[model samples]
Target: MQVEMQDIHKAFGKNQVLTGVHFELLPGEIHALMGENGAGKSTLMNILTGLHQADRGTILINGKERSFSSPKEAEQNGMAFIHQELNVWPGMTVLENLFLGRELKNGFGFLKMKEMKALAKEQFERLDVDIPLEQEAGLCSVGQQQMIEIAKALMVNAEVIIMDEPTAALTDREIAKLFEVIDTLRKQGVSIVYISHRMEEIFTICDRITVMRDGQTVDTTKIADTTFDEVVKKMVGRELKDRFPARAASLGEVALEVRNFTRKGAFENISFSVRAGEIVGVSGLMGAGRTEIMRAIFGLDRMDSGELYRNGKKIKVHSPGEAVKHGIGLITEDRKDEGLILDFSIRHNIALPNVEGLSSKGFIDGKEEQQFVEDLIKRLTIKTESAETSAGNLSGGNQQKVVLAKWIGTNPDVLILDEPTRGVDVGAKREIYALMNELTDRGVAIVMVSSELPEVLGMSDRVIVIHEGKLSGELSREEATQEKIMTLATGGE
Candidate 1:
């Protein structure tokens, strides 16, 4: 099937999301839609998938004019949309979720459980996946759930599928498997609209690329004819330079220390220390105890036994309140769920950590709160509408900045960040690195855990590797290499 969207325009109140953007997908080709956060990639795809109607646009399918009223209509017409956030129900089994909308029914109007399972199993087999069909989707890993979503698309014989950031949470092995599946689909004459911020994946899987900037189409080019530098320049409309900022010049005394941190099967004897003005990058594979360690320090998760020290004095953190009171802040991996309350305004999120300072005897000083939020928002370059906009309403990058603002407002001595730039764009990533440099320059200790090797190598002053819930090795910035990090992460001597 051939899809064409011409002269698309969309707006939400005063925000002009898309401005006369044009996009197309040819049959059996992988077309990459590349852009930064708030560059209108999601809005353009939303319009194509029938989730939102473009204020002014025209869509044609195989030379026939069509406007879908719902996602079902689009699916029925051979179009499928895969969102960045997986849409599987944690409580439902894989078989149940696969046939959720279009379930097989028996003559008695009851669900045909056997038929559904058989079909789901067949689809899994077709995709070369060995998933537990009866297992609850929530129990499955993120990569397995993603494969199930692809199988859902296959069940409907979707010819044109829009996959948004499909590999954001996947490990290296899972990503390779996903690429294999994408290759199979391509051979089946299935057209794919792949969206992502990762440069290497775009060049690897996409045959053609289209760049969008500030709600308009910048240029479309083939992978063979264009270079990475050119594509990045087109995306940001800025000069090409390094993605990671310069590291801090010097380090201070140890600010945070953890000794013999034990959590049974989760992690054991985990120990590390961070000096002021230093960035420590924790590198590991999935389930390597990196996030578990951070959570324990921040009081989100408890350790069976451990010793935590702040400024050389031993302390205990039984809850998150205590962590914050001790001048410790955590920017969680999933910003939408763990970091911010989506329904609250930017001001509220920034003020949440400092409520005690802004309140007196349970009474909040509105003037003080406003003044504080305004200054922080300006300092952080958070792109929001007057600090009154809801955090949920902001783009991915700006939302991350808001998360940073909230943490920085707490005036923390030690900060913990987990996968800070997981789904953010290039421009936002550079900004975030610059922010880290700014923070460390002021002698704030930082512990960062990232799965991206480039990020770990580029920003970390020291790199620590974990394997199977144990500390593998540590390397200084001058000594660390991606090969060495991987070796340690996989239990090398």
Candidate 2:
């Protein structure tokens, strides 16, 4: 399918999301849609997939004007959208999820289990996926779930597929497998609209790139013709100075120490320490127990036997409240579920932890709360209409800023950040790094858990690798190269 979206315009009440944006996808070509969050890339794709109706636009499919009233209509017409957030039904079997709403049945309305299983098996084989058909989707790893989604899209015989951050949850091996499948799809004459913030993957896999900024198309050029800096400039409408900010380190006494931390089936005998005015990055592949260790420290999960010390004093954290009281704050990796309440306003979300400071004698002080929230909003440069706006309405990058704002209000001595810039763009990433530098300057100890190696190398004063729930290796700033880190993370000496 040759898809063309011309002059697309969309709005939600007062906010204009997409304004005169244009995009195109050629058959058998992987076209990258590059932009910062809230730049209207997702909005334009939603319009194409029929999830949102465009107020003004023209969609041409193979030179014929067309519009789909629903996503089902779009998929049936050979277009499928794989969202950034996996839509797998956790409780159902992998096969069930693959054929969820389109189950096979006989004329008598009886289920054709054998036929469905055979079809699903064929699809998985084609994609080189090894997941068991009867295995519950939720039990599968993040990488397995990603493969399932791609297999599901292929099962529909989709001629055009839109993949939004498809490899966000995948590891290096899984990403390689996905790329192989994409190569096969291209050879089979399928068009792909690849949406991702990873510049390396975009340049490696995409033939052409379309850059969007503030709801409009800025440039569309072949990958060979454009440079990484050029694409970034078009996306952010500015020259982004550095991918990671420069900071001089001044080490202090140990701030937080985990001794013999053990969580059965999660992590075991993990021990680490972070000093004031330092960033200790925890580098690992997905499911390497990096997040589990952070959660245990934050009292989100129970540790079998471990000791936590803050400022050289032993502390017990039985709950998040207790952790906070001990001057520890955690920015969870699963932000949507664990970080912020979608229905809450920005003020409320930020104030949830700082309520004591914002309240007087159990009575809320509206003025003080407003000032506090507004100050953080300004400090973080969060893009929102107002502090009263629902956090769910903000884009991924701004939402992350709001999460950081929540932690910043607490003024914790030790802060644990998990995947701090997972879905964030290059510009927002630098801003986050700058914020990290500022925090360290204030003598705050940071434990950063990340899957991005460049981030682990760039922002960390020291790096620790985790593999299969244990500390694999440790490296200093000067010694931490990608090859060395990968070797350690994969359990090599």
Query: Highest TM-score among the candidates is held by which one?
Result: 2
Q: Which pairs of residues collide in candidate 2?
A: none
Residues 112-198, candidate 2: write the lDDT tens digits: 999999999998887677889999998887668888998899889899999998988788877887899899899999999999999
Q: Estimate, for each residue in 170-207, the C-alpha lDDT of model 1 and write its tens digit.
A: 67776887798889899999999999889999989999
Shift of residue 162 alpha carbon in model 2, Å:
0.7
Q: Against the unseen true structure, what C-alpha lDDT does each candidate score?
A: 0.88, 0.91
Top candidate, metric lDDT = 2
Global lDDT of model 2: 0.91
Q: TM-score for each prediction?
A: 0.95, 0.96
Inter-residue clash pairs, candidate 1:
none
Residue-level error in angstroms, candidate 2, position 405: 1.1
- Error in Å for residue 449 of model 1: 1.0
